[model samples]
Each structure stands twice: as structure tokens, then as C-alpha cells.
Target: MSRDTGTDTAGMTFLESTPKKMLNAYLPLGAFLFVLLFPFYWMAITAFKPDNELLSRDGNPFWINSPTLAHVKKLLFDTAYPEWMWNTVVVSVTATFFSLAASVLAAYAIERLRFSGAKQVGLAIFLAYLVPPSILFIPLASVVFQLGLFDTRLALILTYPTFLIPFCTWLLMGYFRSIPFELEECALIDGATRWQILTKIVLPLAVPGLISAGIFAFTLSWNEFIYALTFVSSSEIKTLPVGVVTELVEGDVYHWGSLMAGALFGSLPVAFIYSFFVEYYVSGMTGSVKE
Candidate 1:
């Protein structure tokens, strides 16, 4: 009877301690989630608030008095927003695809082939990435003008690949090295050509790394301001960053509402891409570590 009572107390204590352990485990995660999400939440709330309410100092900080679609409508309708968005999309997609294609081939060559000066070439390309775009853009601008591609989306597409491909190649080289060579040997024995093996086996296996590199390239091109501002002087060819800043502010007067809306809208696609491919992004970032 005393033994039964002791067991009952012990079980109750264990159950109580379980909740405490669970809380301890979840507390840090909860805090981190709040920290990361709070700014986005604030931006979203501000985006919905009426201009008057947004400008008001006495109103609720977290909640808006009046929510309206005026800002969103103005951003979409009253500006070169569509053209800017299209330019960004075109440049980002083209740059990402070209960068990935070039990087994969370069990486595969470096990892699989024993060519003279291949190592030196890879090192040179990696070093190129360290040169700031600020410096490169000046010389590149002259070249673009000489090539008659200035103030054109084509110029941006052409220039972005120079920076993107090298870094992506180096990243993928590390990842490719991590893949077991025995797999390639077996594929070769099975009568698979180099192209067939790369397309069927190597590429499929390197999807995560490819996705990471592609995302990096896409985001870099999409958010780039200096190049877009320098190279694309025409409003028609301007991307979101340059277009939004240039159009939304008319000297001393600022279009805060539309600016905020554009920022939020511009960021949405990137956020979606990251969310959907989160696992791949994580794997790609970590999987390249060569032991």
C-alpha cells in the first residue's frame, strides 16, 4: 500500500517535470522566432495602414486605425512598377540560369579532370569575386558603352554573370568534390558518356548545391542597386531597387506608402523561394564541407 503510494507520487513528479523540460527546449526557439519575424510583421502591418495612420504618432504601434489598399493600388498602377518588376525578373532569371550552367561545367571540370593550369584558373576566378563591384562597374561601364549595350537590360544580364559565375563555380567545385568518384566510375562502366552521367547522375545529386548557388545568384542580381543605377539610366530598363527609389521620391516629397509597398512586394518572391527551398538551402550551405 505504501509502495503503491510511492509509485503514484513518482509518476506525477515525472509528468510535471516533462512539461518543464519541454518548455526549456521550446523557449529559445520561441524567442528566436519572435525576433526574426517581428520586423516583417511590422512592415506588413505598416503596409496595410492608411497613410494618415502611418504618419500619426499617437496611434497604436502594432495595430493600425484604418487599413486600406490605396498604397498597394498606387504602387501597382501609378508608377513604372510593372516595368521595373519585369526587368528585375528577366535579369535575375537569366543571370541565375547562365551562372548555374557555367558554374556546373567549370566545377565538374575542376573536380573530375586533370588539365594543366585548371587549379590556377579556378583560383583566379575565385579571386575575381573579391574585387568590389564598385571598382569593376567603372571599367565595365566603359566597356558596355563601347559594346553599345549601355542603358539596356542586356548590359545588366551580361555584367552580372561575370561576378556570379566565379563564386558559383567555386562553391559547386567544393560540392562536386564531396560527391564520391566511384559513382561516376560505375556510370562510365555502364556505357554512360560524360554528358549522360553529368545530366543523369551528377546534376540530380547536386540539386541542393545548385539550388543554393542559383538562389544566391538570383538574389544578388535582383537586389543589386549600384549596377542597375549606373548602367540603366532609362526608366524603362530600371529594376525594382533603382526604380522604386528614383520614382517614389520627388525631391523633398517622399511617397512613404508606395515605397513601403514596393519594398514589401519586391521582397515577397525571394521570401517565397527561400521558404519553399529551405531544406535545400540548408543542405547546400553545409554539404560542401570537404573532409
Candidate 2:
């Protein structure tokens, strides 16, 4: 009888301790997930809800009634969403490719070459990134105007590189520094040119950093509002951020549902790209920081 009582007390104690331990382990994780996901959840829900339901005072925060596809349809058919989307794609893809190309070459030169003032040049490039776009845009506007690219996609594609290349060059330089030079030395001894070594060996090793730089450049162009807004004035030439905010919002009559829908859709491409290459993205970002 005493033995049975002891076993019962031990089992009860184990059960109580197990839950406490599990809670301690998972509570922070659960809270973090909720905080990260709640805004996305709200946006998705609000996108589906009808205008009347969205504006309802008695509507539940966590649940919506009378869901409709009107906002999605309007965004797709009744607005310039498609044009804006295409413009964003063009600008982002063009800017990203150019930025990556420039960054890779610049980073390779800075990392491999033992020239005078190389370190200072690299630092100056990074400091260029620190300069406020507000101050630079005025000067850039004159350059774009002189180049006959005003109110055109060329204006954005050309101007985006000025900002992207500097930071991206700095990022790739750090990443390239982390790579050992022994591999390149051997390739050089085997009659490989600098261009050949970069194309065949260094580039393959730096794929993660390249992808990271490309992703950063793409996201920067995609989300850039100030430059896009300041440079492009025509409705047909506007990119997503400026187009969505200015064209979608009618004075004080805000279309929250449609606006949220546009934002959600605009973010989908980037989200998909990031999700697919998340491992490389993480490695690249962390590796650059470490170097």
C-alpha cells in the first residue's frame, strides 16, 4: 500500500513537471510566431472581406463575415494594377541584374587587387550608401533630365544602380574576403586569367553572396518609393509603391480593402523568391556579416 502511494505521487509530479517544461520551451517561440504572422494574417483576412464588413464597427478582429472577391477583382480588372505590376517587375529585374554585375566585378577587384587606396575606395563606396537619397535625388534629377530619361522607366533603372551598387559592392567585398586566395592562385598557375578565375572558380564559390546581393537589390528597387516618386510623374510610368499609394487612394476616401490587397499581391513575388532560396539567403547574409 505504501509502495503504491509512492508511485502515484511520482507519476503526478512527472505529469506536472512535463507541462511546465514544455511550456517554458515553447512559450517564447509561440509568441514570436504570433507577432510575426499576425499582420500578414490581418492583411489576408482584410483583403477577402467586403468593404461594408471591413468598415463595420461590430466586426470581429480575428474573424470576418460576408467575405467577397470584389477587391481582388477590382484590383485585377478595374484598375492600373497590372501596368503598375509590370512596371515594377521591369524596374526590379533590370536594377537587380545590373547591381549584381557591378557589385561582383567591384567586389572582386577590391578583394583581389593590392592597389593603393583600395581600402579607402571601398570605405568611400560604403559611405556613398550612407548619403541620404533626399540630398542626392535633386542632383540625380538633373542628371536624368540631361540624359533625356525624365518620366521614363530608364530613369529608375539607371538611377537605382547608383544606390544599389555601392552597398552591394561593399557586401560582396566582405563575402569575397572570407574566401581563401589559394584556390585562385592555383588556377592562375594553371594559366587561368583573372576573368577566367572569376568566372569559373570565384563566382561558383561566391554564389550565395551573389544571390544575397541580387535579392537585396531586387527588394530595394521593388520597394523604392522616394526615387520612383520623384523621378517618374506620368501615370503610365509609375512603379508599384508610388502608383499604389497615389492612384489607389482618392483624397480622404481610402479603399483599405483594395489597398491591402494590392500590397499583399505586390509582396507575393518577393516572398516566393525568398522562401525558395531561404537557405542561401540566410548563409549569404550571415557570412557577409561574419567576414
Candidate 3:
């Protein structure tokens, strides 16, 4: 009877009781956040923990009572971590630049040039990205040896493009497709060359896609272990991912604190980069999907 007097407000209520909101959304999200962040929490605690506390079976293991800088000192001073960090930065940056350059040209050709079998070519290029690095590493190693690039950062810088190019090309093509062909047609009528159109108009508009592709390529290069391990032998030329794993552990012995410190430091740059460019990344993805 009361319900007849007042129409149902079910759709009007954005949220119900506090307990319902907590149960329906907050609890699940909180649990996911806890699971996701627990590793970093443990890593931070372990990195600052003294050897005694880390090894001891007593006291609270989750929290560090007395934090020390011993692990940080060891990671910075005793290890080739600094060199590894530098190598990672140089290789990742160079590879990303090269990949983006090649991908832009390739994507433009595939999307705007209207070449024969362009769609098929794009599909093939994307399929190349599906090829596992594990399978590719063997032949790539032979090529690296034959080219006399073994045990050098150049091998990684060059070979990373092989994989990076395909993915970046596919991503950029999607973005380029989202753009109006009318612009290019108008430019053609106005006597603008393809190079001028791309450099002056297309590239400027595709900045978000470029950033997304660059960030992806850089992150992949940073975290790549199989290729880094296969191509580079010197500890000084190793990437952060390879160096931390190979250099930190001895037979039946693990330098837990120093290892965790390396991991924490290694992850910080990527986290910072993603946090800064999240908006552009989202826009790029949305634009690509709209095509």
C-alpha cells in the first residue's frame, strides 16, 4: 500500500546502506589491493631487515623493528647494480626509439598508403609478436654470434626491435586507423607530400599512441630476461632483471636483503613512469579500440 503511494526508487539510489556498499564494492577492491601490494610490502620489510631478523624464526616477520641500510649499501657499492641500471636505461631507450621510428613508418604505410594486401600484412606482423622469445632466442643467439655482437648491449638493442616493431606497428596502425582519412586526402589535394603529412599532421596528433608504444617497448626491454641473459655475458652489461637474479644468489645461499633491495629499486622507475603517463596511456588505448 505504501509502495503504491511512492514509486520504486531502486534505480534512483546510486548506493544503498554503508554496509551494502562496503560489502558490494569496497571489500572486494580492498582484498585485491592487499593481494597486489603484499609483495612490495614484504620486499620493503625484507630489504631493511638485518640478517639476524631475516634468518630468525622468532618475532614478527611481517614488520621490521630495526631497519638498517646494510642491504642498500651492499647493493649500491658491492654489486654491479649501478652498471646494470645504466645498461637497462641505455638499451631500453635506444630500442624504444628505434622501434617507434620503424613502427610509425610501417603503420603509416599499412594504414594510409592503401597498398595491396595491407590488411594481410598487418595481420602477419601482429602474428610475429605471438612468437615466443624462448623459441626465437636460439636462432637469434646464432645470429648474434655470427654478427660478432655476442656479450654486448648492442645485441639486445638491435634484437629488441625485432619484437618491438611488430607490436608497436600493430598498435600504431589501430590509432592511425581511428584518424580521419579526410585529413590525408585534403593534404594530398593541397600538394602535401606523404612525409609532410605524417611529420606535420599525423605525428603531432598521434603523440599519445607514440607514448603508449614507447612506454610498452621500454618496459618490455627493462624486464626481458631470456634475451638479456642469452646475449650479454658481462655483469656490467646485464639488465636489472637478469643481474638481480644471477648475481644475488650463490649455490644454496641467497642474499635476501640485497636481492629485495635490487628488485625494489628496479621497479620504482617503471612505477613512476606509468603513474605519470597513465592518462596518455588510457587515451591511446581508447583511441586504438575505437578503430
Candidate 4:
């Protein structure tokens, strides 16, 4: 009985010695979740809240007294929002596709070709990615004007690759490096051409990496403001980021409800994509390359 009693006391002491899970885990997690989700919650509420409630201070600021779809209706019917959505999708997808194709070729050549000054070329590409879009837009604007591509979706598609290619190349270089070289050697021994090896073996194995790069490029293109603002002047050709801010406001007056609605709606597609492929994104970033 005494031995059992001692054992129970020891177990109780061990339990007491353990760090507090509430403080170490749940508290931090809860706080992080609140911080992360608070903006979305605010945007959602603002999107739904009637203009009277949005401007009024009589009720709880966080809670919507009455919800209406008037703002969404205005955004959809009264503005060129649908066109902006279409433009955004077209530009983002096209840009991401071209960027990924170029990145795959560039990354593969840099990592596998073993050519002279390969490391220098890779480093230079990454350095180009580090260049600010704010600076590049000035020169890019000149080129866009010269090419007569200004205010066209084709302009965005072509220009987005300038930044997208470098970053995607850098990301894919790391992923490609993680892949075993033995596989390529074996393919070469089996009389497979470099093209066949890349298409059948390397690319198939690098789907996670490709998806990660695609997501990044797509998100960047989707949210791109400076180039979109600078290049596209017409409402019909403007992207979501540029169109929402430009068309929604008239001089000093701000349409908070419509603005929030536009932002919330515009953000949903990217959020959906990210959530859907988050696991692949994680693996790609972590370079889980298998033999």
C-alpha cells in the first residue's frame, strides 16, 4: 500500500513538473489565430454591413447590426469588377505559366548542365529578383510604351516574367539540387536524351516544386499594383488591385463598404488556392526531394 502510495505521489509530481500547455501552446496558438484571422473578419463584416452601420458609432464596432449585399451588388453590377476579375485571372495564369516554363528551363540548366559560370549566372538571376519593382517599372514603362503594349493584358503578361522568372528560378534551383543526380545518370545510361529525362523523370518528380513556384508567381501577379497601375490606364483593362482603388473612389470620398467588399472578394480566390495546395507548398519549400 505504501509503495503504491509513493508511486502515485511520484506520478503526481511528474505531472506537476510538466510545463503548462495552456501558456506554451494554446495561448500562443489562440493569439496567433486571432491576429491572423482578425483582418479577414473585419473585411467580411465591413463588406456585409450597411453604410449606415459602417459610418455609425452607436453599436458594437466589431459586430454587424444588419447585413446587406448592396455593396457586393454595386461592386458586381455598377462597377467593372467582373472585367477586372477576368483580367486578373488571365494575367496571373498566363504570367505564372510562362514564368514556370522559363524557370524550369533556367533552373535545370543552372543546376544540372554543369556549364561554365553556372553558379555566377544563378546568383545574378537571384540578384535580379532582389531589384525593387518600383525601380524596374520606370524602365519597363518605357519599353511597354515603345512596344505599343501599354494598357493591354499582354503587357502585364510579358512584364510579370521580368520579376517572376528570377525568383522562380532561384526557388527551383534549390529544389532541383535536392533531387538525386544518380537518377539522371541512370537515365543517361538507358539511352534517354536530356529532353526525355527532364520531361519524364525530373519534371514528374518536381511537381511539388513547380506548384510552389506557380503559387508564388500567381500571387505576385494577382497582387501586382505598381506595374498594373502604371501600364493600364483604362478601367476595362485594369486589374483588381488597380481597378478597386482607382474606380471605387471619387476625389476625397471613400466607399468603405464597396472597397471592403471588393477586397474580400478579390482575396478569396488566392486564399482558396493556397489552402488547397498548402501541403505541396510546404514540401516544396522544405525540399522533400526523393530518389
Candidate 5:
């Protein structure tokens, strides 16, 4: 066998040029970065910008000449922003916990229980996630009202699991399927109960999958709008997304500074979490791809 050393050397030479690298790699990345980050940049600048600069067309819209803490102060003091943040945290954490617990059980059962029609059952669960929340919200509204859970954190916490459990279960099923069956069989031979195997053996190895599912579930619950709007009516119980949009903007007037401030602050936690778990997230996603 002959190696195509000339072709390889030519390809490497082409990539070695700074201009070629800039055109092929940096340019596209620059565009994508600009598009992805512009909104956040705008939001950050708008939060600190004085009203004159924000509204007036006389100066630079991209940078603030004089930054002010007014928006942050106003957002924290004038509205139920703090309450909204607390409510979002509570609902997201509670719902994510319930959904993950249920998903782990369902995923393990489907992947490990050796049940009849297991593949079909797993497909059905994933398909359930495809159904739009908009259509489900109307019917869920009736159920919420009948159960007297309307306008409360309990309403959001419980209803969130409907959408959350299906996706989490599907994600976790892929992860669980990747585990070697021989390991599970070994556990069984050692007289470990199914629950013990799940809690001790499977869960320990599936940490990345759990983190991915949790991050997704928590983010969904945090930014959820329709269910938050439908189930919650009170300012105190409203989550960050709903509270920021509804309370910050009066019918005809928009508090641009405060609105941007609320958005900026509201997004920080999610960003922080993504930065922290991004490795596990990528691993969990690619883990299923390999299986």
C-alpha cells in the first residue's frame, strides 16, 4: 500500500495559511458568535443605559456612555421580581426532582425489566414529548381548576412533570441502554434487589445522563410561559418569565431598562449551570448516539 503523502502535504499547506484559516474558520465563527451574542449584548447594554441614550438616536446604541444602577434597583424594588425568581427556583427544582425520579424508574424498567413490548413503550414515551404544550394546556387547564390547584406553585410543580417525565425518560432510557447487561446480571447474581441495583449500580454510572436530563428539565421549568401564565394568576407565585414580561410592561408603555435588567438577571443562573455541566451534557448526548 502506498501513502498519498503529496496529497496530505498539499492539504496541510492549504490550511497553514493565516488568510485561509481566517476565511474558512474564523469568519463563520465570527458571524455565528455575533448572531448568538447580539441579543445578550443588547440586553446587557440596555440594562445599564440611561433612558436618554436608549430612546434618543443621537448617540451609540451599542455602548453606554454613563451606566446606571437605576434599572437593577427599580427591578428589585418596584416589582415582584424577587418573588418571581424564588417561585421559578422552587417550581423548577421541585418539578425537576419529581420528573427525574419518575424518569429514572421508567427508563430502568423499560430498559432492564425485560417486559413485553418494551421498545414500543419506549417509542410511545418519546413520541409523547413531541406533542405541543399549547394543545395540552387547554385540557390541563380544566384538570388544574377541577383539582383546585390553579394559581399556585403546586399547580406548576405537578403539571410540569407531564412534559418533563416523557423527555427525561426517553433521554435516560438511551443512557441506561448503553450500560452492559453483564454488569446488571452480576449484581443480580450477588442477590442485590432491583431497587438496590438501580440506586447503587446504575445510577452511579449514569450521572452524566442524569445531569443532562436535570439541566434540560430545570431550564424548561424555569422558562416555561404558557403553563405559568395559565395556572398562575398571582404576582407572588408567578415565575420570572411571566412576571418580567407581564409586570414590566404596562399596556402601552415598556420599561426598557428594567425589562432588560430582569431578563439579564433571570438568564444568569441558566448560563452558569450550562457552563458548569456542559461537559456532562455533551457526554450524555453523544453517549446515546454511540448506543
Candidate 6:
């Protein structure tokens, strides 16, 4: 009886013990959550903190002593932040729309059309995505200048697709491949045209993939800095990322409160989008289809 009891205890000890579970699961999860969330927490607190507390080294930096809305008010009323936000939304939406439209056709063609050199073409598209924006931006800047689109929202709307299209195409190609080809064949046998087949059968099933691509494209366009900064010079045409950085700081003087406020507000929309469509995003990324 003693020997049996010892064996049972040893077998159960490491994997099922409370302390071991805490160490292996809870502790690691807690650490990850802290690391992931600490920056946003800091940004939120800093946005609301008064200048005195923000600048002073005396009090607990983690906690807000006196939260105020002055920074937010200034950001909204005293600056071109509203215009910046509007510009960002407009440019991002337009670019994502066009990118998705083009990518859908490209991905569907490459994946379903059985065209010659399709794989090579798809490879070329993915390779385009690997090109760093920093290098590409220079020539793009000259083109924008030549076209006299400098300091205009149109420049960014057009230029963003240069990067957005390749990535979205690559993503959607993988998704389109996961879909069963027999669906298209069945539609074809029933005398459906290619366009009808694509519109009716393929698109309905690819909603998650479309949303996922849109999310990625929109986020990239929204947060893009180099093209926005290079192509747009006017405050009214600037996107949130560039506007906040340029307008909030003055030669070694950082407006920490207003800067944090801008960042926090700008980030909220993307976070909300991700949380809302996370299910579809995951499904799309996995590229799995039910037959």
C-alpha cells in the first residue's frame, strides 16, 4: 500500500500540482500580458496626465495623480488633428479599396484561371512585396513631383497601392487556392460564365479573406509615414502618424501629453477593427476552406 501510494504521488506531482501549473501557465501568461499591455497603459496614462506630473520625477509615473482633458482638447480644437485624421481615413479607405479590387482579380486569375506562367507571375508579385519601401519611395517621390501631386492626398492614395497590392495579392492567392476548384468546375458545367462563377461562387466564400486583406491594407495605409511625409507637405493633407509627430514637437521641446493623446486616439480605431473581425482574420490567415 505504501509503495502504490508513492508511485501515484510521483506520477501526479509535476504536471498536476498547483504550484507547477502556476509556474508553467499562469506566470508566463501574466508576464506576456504585462509586456504586451504595458506600453498602451503607459500611453493612456501619459495622455491624461497633467504637465506637471508628466514632467516631474517625484511621483509614481505609473499612476495618474490628476487626469485632465486639456491635451485632448488642444489636440482636437487647437490643431489640425481633425483634418489629419480625416485625410488618413480617406486615403486609407480609398487605397485599400483599390488594392483589394485589383488583388482579387490578380489572385483569382493566378490561382483559378490555369493560365501559363501563373506560378511565376505569383512569385513575381510576392517578390515585389519584399522590396523595401524606403528604396522605392525615392523614385515614387520624383514621379509624384513630376505629376505635380506633391502635397496632395491623391499622391498617397495612389502610391500606397504600390506596396499594398503585392501583399494583398499574395495573401488572397493563398486563400483562393485553399478553396476547392470543383466548385468552379460544377458552376462551369452548369453553363455559368467565368465572371458569374467568380462573382457568385468564389466571392461569397472568400469574404473572410477579403476582410483580412482589407484590414491589412487599411492598417498599412493608415500608419504609413515615409510616403505620406514625402508626398504631402501641407498640414491638412498629412496623415495621423506624420502629423502628430511633426506638429506636436518643436525643436527639442516635446509635447508629451498631446503626443500621447494623438497616438492613443489614432491607435484605438485599428484596435477596435482587429477585435471586431479577429475571427475572420484568423480564419483568413489560416487559408482553410470547408469543402
**Alpha carbon RMSD to native, model 4:** 7.6
Estimate the Cα RMSD of every predicted model relative to the unseen true structure. 8.1, 8.7, 6.3, 7.6, 4.8, 7.2
Give the distance in Å from residue 217's predicted Cα in candidate 6 to where it truly belongs. 1.4
| Pairs with steric clashes in candidate 6 | none
Error of 3 at 49 (Å): 1.3
In candidate 3, stretches whose alpha carbon ends up further than 4 angstroms from where it belongs are 1-15, 282-291
Off by over 4 Å in 2: 1-25, 59-61, 284-291
lDDT of each: 0.82, 0.84, 0.88, 0.88, 0.88, 0.87
- Model 6 scores a C-alpha lDDT of 0.87
TM-score of each: 0.84, 0.86, 0.91, 0.89, 0.91, 0.90
Displacement of residue 137 (Cα, Å) in model 4 is: 1.1
Best by lDDT: 5
- Give a tens-digit lDDT track for model 4, residues 179-210: 89999999999999999988999999888788
Q: Write the per-residue lDDT of candidate 3 for residues 77-146, one digit (tens) a residue.
A: 9999999999999999999999999999999999989799998998898788778899999999999999
Using lDDT as the yardstick, the better of models 3 and 5 is: 5
Residue range 1-291, candidate 2, lDDT tens digits: 013333455334454676786686578789999999888888898888888787778858567777888999999988899999999999999998988898888888887874788888888887787777888898899898999999999999999998889878888887788789899999999999999999999899887778888877787888888889989998888998898888999899899889999988988888988898776566555644443
Question: Worst lDDT window (10 residues) for model 3?
Answer: 1-10
Of candidate 4, the 10-residue stretch with the lowest lDDT total is 1-10
Worst 10 residues of 5 by lDDT: 1-10
